[model samples]
Target: MDIRIGIKDSAREIAFDSAQSPKEVEEAVVAALDSGHLTLDDAKGRRYIVPSAGIAYVEIGSESTRKIGFVA
Candidate 1:
């Protein structure tokens, strides 16, 4: 899954790939909001923690399904 995190007052967004399911991600986001900090792990095992107050938006992409050729 691809996740993009937008920070307040920043033009560049933080993007990473993870293996977490949609439900898991949603739970994490909620937990972060309550705890005041967001923590996430990438596919490569790198951990990212950001202050919840600095987060502008979170865009999560669902797991990609393989497709062949062009649309007809």
Candidate 2:
């Protein structure tokens, strides 16, 4: 299984093959925000503002690559 992370402004991508849970993904996002690498806004105490400036993707198992599409 390969997971790829893409950025809209750059052609290079970051790929990882380790398995991670959904919670791990969330934790990573939070860590990125805290580190000032990612911008996240809070709304209604439970909502988060996801930046759409860059493109991200993840591949699970042997299926085709999936884009990380999120609603604003």
Candidate 3:
């Protein structure tokens, strides 16, 4: 799975194998959810909070972007 992480006011791409054990990923996701720094309604609702970064936001797969063959 490809995921984006926010680091020091910037976003970076991360890759995780979908076939790996789900435990670590699940734990990370849960921790992120509990952090409360990620608001589901920020930047028109495309951002989430990560422990290492203040905010993790994505602008991928939008209608216009998709039409132009861009994948985020």
Candidate 4:
């Protein structure tokens, strides 16, 4: 899954890839917002934590495959 996190006052949003389902990610974001902290684990086992209060939005979408070479 592809996830993008918008932070308050930040020009660029945080983007990452995760193995978690959309529902799971939404639940985690809600839980973090309620608890004032957000934690996420990526597909590579890397973890990320941020302040929930600073989160502007959370975007979750399906991953897209990158195409190489030219198509006719």
Clashes of each: 0, 0, 0, 0
Which tens-of-lDDT digit does each residue in 28-59 have in candidate 3?
55566667543222333344434544545432
- Candidate 4 local Cα displacement, residue 43, angstroms: 1.1
Name the candidate that leads on lDDT.
1
Worst 10 residues of 1 by lDDT: 18-27
Q: What is the per-residue lDDT of model 2 for residues 35-60, given as tens digits with 9 covering 90 to 100?
A: 64543222223323334345464333
What lDDT score belongs to each candidate, Candidate 1 first?
0.92, 0.48, 0.40, 0.91
TM-scores of the candidates in the order shown: 0.88, 0.38, 0.27, 0.83
Instruction: Write candidate 4's Cα lDDT for 6-64 as tens digits.
Output: 99999999889999988999899989978989999988999989899889999999767
Model 1 regions more than 4 Å off: 67-72
Per-residue lDDT, model 4, residue 68, is 100
Evaluated against the true structure, the overall lDDT of model 2 is 0.48
Please give the distance, in angstroms, between residue 70's alpha carbon in candidate 4 and its true position after superposition.
11
| Winner by lDDT between candidate 4 and candidate 3 | 4
Candidate 3: pairs in clash: none
Give the TM-score (vs. native) of candidate 1.
Answer: 0.88
Candidate 2 stretches with Cα past 4 Å from truth are: 37-72
Candidate 4: residue pairs that collide: none
Rank list by lDDT: 1, 4, 2, 3
Error of 4 at 12 (Å): 1.2
